[model samples]
Target: MDKQGANMTTNTRIYLRASTDQQNASRAEASLLEFANLHKLNVVHTFIENESGASLERPELFKLIAASKQGDILLCESTDRLTRLSNEAWDTLKQSINEKGIRLVMLDLPTSHINLSNAGDDVTTAIMKAINSMIIDIMAAMARKDYMQRRERAAQGMAKARAEGKLTGRKVNTVTNDKVIKLLKAGTHSWSEIVDLCGVSRAQVAKLAKVVKAEA
Candidate 1:
């Protein structure tokens, strides 16, 4: 009845990500790796990155997809770890995953674990796929909703603070910002390289670069 026997090696790629560089991207790595070992899944690669879940510009995530083939599991700690993208972006991501025939497995989504093994009958597998897809889609939608809600709440808080004369806006970290500006002024490194070096956004570097050029 079970197609994937004891000796069947499942190629699983574990992805760990965080929204910002300050957060440890590998925070979930140990647990996910332990899960893989417990499940006997063969982990062929591990991709980690410090990137926002709001955007689909994560290089490591796309790289993992490119490296995977049909039946290969794209494993992550949770649905939110995979995405907190808006509906359109999430649809795009889902399209890519489906088109590539990659299996999505989340540690929190037990339903998706069914796809990890080839042990079920066709009917059972079909049922599991339907259930898993439905559950994951719901989770993705909720994640997106949560992200939007948090952003809305932040905006509201900012507005309230402004009205109360309590908001001075974000204070520029002169130490970091000046360092980034100096790097840009040096004209020696690329924006991305500067971003990595200074732990600041590309837009921040570009803004500082424009100011420096204007002052010159």
Candidate 2:
């Protein structure tokens, strides 16, 4: 919390996340709000996500990043909650923070504090800050490695089940039958566009078109 800017409220975006939808969404927020209050942050908006942090398609997080203004602080409960499951994803998130000119403030690590307003003071504080950032990176990497190991184990289990001739996974929607068939015949667009529209692949489109022709 910068005392000079304390009286004048600044834009702050809050991020709250849970491991899964089954978890209590409010738990993250409750703790984060206390942190925000202690820092006197004027929370302009909040992005709450109920999914694994690895997923690139976090709609709320994307919205928050897009909506964030320069000098706006992104407040989170902890770095681990902010990113897990992939080092690549963590890199992407860090890139977003840098490119967006958004300062990230974590409650747990005070040394990770970023003072965008005070450039002269920053040089003196650089070594300590770097050490704290390194600690965070190491912890985040461990969490991501664990997530990958768990995923690999689950995949192996699925493979074993398949070997035993067990059916798995939800069925594809049958409602796309006519639409997919038509798109295959018409071929109105490129393979990429077809994939976007029909939610199928180049191989499926080619196979379907050939089958249709053979039937005709």
Candidate 3:
């Protein structure tokens, strides 16, 4: 930590998220740890989850907020990692964070980096906070826009495929499917547990379970 911020006691909660189970939420864990170490920030906990950024249904995120107290730092790799939520959902999330007096810190946002160090005087702090908040809002909006555009493109592609009579559902990952079948046959793991272990959705597990039962 910088000597200027050494006098302050800053507790940080690191949050890591991946849009899908196939992606490794902890991919940035080492970098985040280095960042906390470099800033001498006390990391109270690290929450990792595989969930869509566009949704407010992330259990781990809410748990993180619940665990945090006033003046605590909620650190992440980027604003997009924290949210690609719709405007209304984003507002709700922002309200929750603000109400808890938690500081939002993203590694990609330079303006937010000041949060890791001493914020100087009250006026400076206020100004910095305002600027940081505005920038974060802008970034969050951009992230949402990008997410929307991607979804639109995907929809258009699917439509085009259907028009061409070439539309088919996504190909099954046979290896993963086979694994799911084996686990279902073993009958030891719960559906939720299998989803976590196989990195497949609960619906997929259920479908596989049906297939296993039919074969039996």
Best by lDDT: 3
Give candidates' CA RMSD values in order: 8.5, 9.8, 9.1
What ranges in model 2 sit over 4 Å off?
Answer: 1-9, 114-121, 153-216
TM-score of each: 0.75, 0.62, 0.74
Candidate 3 lDDT over 57-88, as tens digits, reads 68999998998877889999999999998889
Worst 10 residues of 2 by lDDT: 1-10
- Candidate 3 deviant stretches above 4 angstroms: 1-8, 118-121, 168-216
Off by over 4 Å in 1: 1-9, 119-121, 169-216
Model 1 / residue 7 / CA error / Å: 6.6
What is the C-alpha lDDT profile of model 1 across 1-216, one tens digit per residue?
Answer: 113345655578899988765679899999999998998888888999987787787899999888877778899999999988888998999998888888898998889888787665688789879889999989998888887888799879977987898968677788999998777767789999999999988899878875554320
The alpha-carbon lDDT assigned to residue 14 of candidate 2 equals: 80
lDDT of 2: 0.68
Q: Model 3 residue 63 lDDT?
A: 93
Please provide, for model 2 over 1-216, each residue's C-alpha lDDT reduced to its tens digit, 9 standing for 90 to 100: 222345544577888777655566457776777777776667777788775666554677778888876677787777766777467778888788779877777777676565323344365577765676688788778767776777799879977987796956756455665667776556576757777887777777666555444320
